[model samples]
Target: MNLNPDQITNYANTFIKVLIDYSPKLISAFIILFAGLYIIRLINRFIRSIMVKRNLDPTLTRFLADILLWVLRVVLFVSFISKLGIETSSFVAILGAMGLAVGLSLQGSLSNFAGGMLIILFKPFQVGNTIEAQGVTGTVCEIQIFVTKLITANNQTIFIPNGSLSNGNIINYSLQNFRRADLTIAISYETDIKKVKEIITAVLANNPKVLKIPAAEVSVKNLTDSAIQLAVRPWATNEDFWGVYADTLENCKQAFDAQGIVIQPYVRESSKSSS
Candidate 1:
C-alpha cells in the first residue's frame, strides 16, 4: 500500500473541499439550535405568566408549560438537524410511530390524564369542596394527574378515575354560597294542613343556621291515602347545610309532637290488603 505523491495530494484537496462545502451548514445548524432554544424559553415564560395572571392551578400551569416547551424543542431539533443536510422525514415518522404505539398501550392512562387536565383547567370542583359525581358524594381531598381523591362523610378515602369523573355529572355543593335543604315530612291526614305548615315554618325560622332572605317554604307536596307530604325547603350557608338539614328535621319532629301532629307511616297496597 504505497501511494504515489500525486494520489496523496489529490486526497488532501478532496478532504479540504468537502469541509469547505459543509462548514456553512454546520455553523447555521449550531446557530439555529441556540436561537430556537432561547425562543422556546421565552415562549414558555410568557405562557406561565399568562397562566399565573389567570389564577390557574400551579400544578396545571407547570405541567402544561413543560409540555409545550418539550414539544417546541422537538420541532426545533428537527429543524436544526435538517439544516445540516440530515433527512428528517424518516426520523419524524419513526417518532410518530413510537408515539402511537405507546399511546395505544396506555389508552386508559392517557384518557385519565387528559381528563385530569380538563378538570384542573375547568375547575368543576376544587380540593376541600364537597361534590357528588359518579354516584360518589364526598369532599375532594386531592386532584392528581390520573385520579381524584375524596374523603367521604364516613371518613373513608376513595380514589376515582378522572376519566369517569370529568365525563359524569358533577354536583358541586360548595360552589354556591347558599344551598337549599329539601326535607319531606309526612303527617297523618287527620291533622290540619294549615297548622302543620305554620309549625314547620316556625321551626325553620327558629333555627339560627337557616337563611331568612329567601324565606322558608312549607307546602303540601303530595296527598296519599294515609298522609300528607309536606315539602319543607330551607336555605342555609354551605357550611351549615348538613347541620341545618339535621336540626330542621329534629325540630320539626319535636314541634309536631308538641302539637300532637302524628307522622303517618306509608301504607303499601300489600299491607292494606293484608289488613
Candidate 2:
C-alpha cells in the first residue's frame, strides 16, 4: 500500500522481464496454431481425394471427411493450449465428460447415426433401389445419416429412421436384373382346369417383356371350395416387372372371358345349391 519508488521500479522491471521472456513462446505458439490449421486443411483435402479415387459412397466420404477435419482441429487446439503452459489433461477430461453427457442425452440420434453407417457399409439398399422394409414398400430416394427417404408407388414420400431400417427386414427388388411376377388368378371350379392353364401359358408367351429362356409356368396353386387358384409366374427384366404383371393379369382376364371361364368367390357347391 505504501511502496517506495525503488520498490515500484523493481516491480516494474520484473514485470517487463517476464513479458520479454514469454514473448518468444507466445509468438511460437501463434505460429504453430496457424500452421497446424493449414496442415489440417491439407490433410482433409488429401483424405477426400483418396475417398474419391476409391469410388467410395458419397455420403460416407463426406461424413468421414467432416469427422476427420473436426477431430484434427480439436487436437490442434489442444496442442496450442498446451504450448501456453496450460494443463491439457484437465481439458481432455472435461471434454470427455461433456461428450459423455451429450451422448447420453442424444442416444437415439447417435443410434440412428450408427445405423446409417452400417447401412452405408453393408449396402442393404441404396438410393433408387426399390425395397420393402418395415411394412413400407417404395423406391429409396435418399439414404441419409439419420433417415432414409422412400418414394412409394402412390407418389408419397416416407421418411424412415435409419435405426429401424438397419435392423428391419429389407427386400430389395431392384437387386436382381430379372424378377418373376407371381400372378394368382382364382377361377371357378366349373372352368376346365386344363384349358385355363393353356390360356395362361399362351398369354405369357405373347407378352414381349416376359423372358422365354426360363419359361413361364402356369399351374394350380390351391383348390378352394368354389375356385381353383392358378399361379402364373412370368420372368421379366426388373424394368418391365410392373408392366408385365399388369398386362399379364389383364390379358388373362380377357382370354378367360372369351373362353367362357368364370372366376367366383369361395363358396361351396353345397352352399350354392342350398341358396
Candidate 3:
C-alpha cells in the first residue's frame, strides 16, 4: 500500500518532535553523570592526602576514604538519574532496605569493629610491648583494625580478635621503666632463717643489674608446711628483668649450699596457706 503525502509528512513531524523533546535531556544527563564521577574522584584524592597528613593508620585511612568516595559517587549518580526525569525515591528506599539487611547480617562484625576502634584509640599496648590480655599473655607483635598479634613467652604467635581484647582485661607490663624481679627461695625448717636472709642479701648486692636504690629486701614471708619461705625481691631495669631473675636464683642456690641451707620443693598452686 502506498502512503499519501500528508501521512508521510505527519510521521516525519512526530519523529522530529520526539528527538527535540528527549535528545538534549539525555545528552545533558550523560554529561552530568560523567562529570559527577570525575568530581568524586577528585574529592577522593583530596581525602586521601588529608588522611596521610593526619598520620592515620594506612588500612583505616583506605577504608574510610574509600567509603567516602563511594558515597559521593552514588549520590551523584542518583542525582543525575533524577535529572533525566527518572524517579529515585524508590531506588533510594531499595538501597536503604538493602543497607539495613547488610547491617543486620554483620551486627557481630560491626560491634567487633567498634570495639577495635576503641582499642586503637585507647592504646593499651604497642608493637613489641609485653602484655597480657583476654587470658592470653604475650608480647605484642602487631596491632590492626580487627585483630591483635601476640608472641607468646613460649615462642607462639597468637592472633586474638579485637572484640575479645576490648571486652577483657589488658595488662601492660612494659610501661614501667623498672620492674621487680620477685623470687622466693624456701629453706628447711631446721635452717636458721636469720642466717639465710643475711646470706641472700649479700648475694643480691653483688649483682650489678639488681638496683641498689630498692635496697634488696630479704624477708621471711611464711613458714610453710614443707619449709620456711625466704622471699628475695630485687628491683631491676625492665630490660634486664629476666636476666636478673635467672642470675639471682642460680647464685642464691650456690650461696645457700655453701652455708648448708637445704632448699624446699617448688610450690605449685595451693590455697592452703603456710601452716
Residue pairs in clash, model 2: none
Q: How far is each candidate from the true structure, as Cα RMSD in Å?
A: 4.7, 3.5, 4.8
C-alpha lDDT score of every prediction, in listed order? 0.91, 0.90, 0.85
Cα lDDT tens digits, model 2, 204-270, are: 8888999997888888899876678889899999899899999998998898789887766565456
What is the lDDT, from 0 to 100, of the residue 238 in candidate 2? 86
Q: State the lDDT at 83 in candidate 3.
A: 86
Where does candidate 1 stray beyond 4 Å? 1-50, 72-87, 267-275
What is the descending lDDT order? 1, 2, 3
Candidate with best lDDT: 1
Give a tens-digit lDDT track for model 1, residues 4-53.
99999999999999999999999999999999999999999999999999
Better of 1 and 2 by TM-score: 2
Question: Residues 206-232, candidate 3, lDDT per residue (tens digit)?
Answer: 999999887778998888677888778
In model 3, the Cα lDDT at residue 140 comes to 85
Candidate 2 lands at a TM-score of 0.88
Residue 51 in model 3: shift from native, Å?
4.6
> TM-score for each prediction?
0.74, 0.88, 0.76
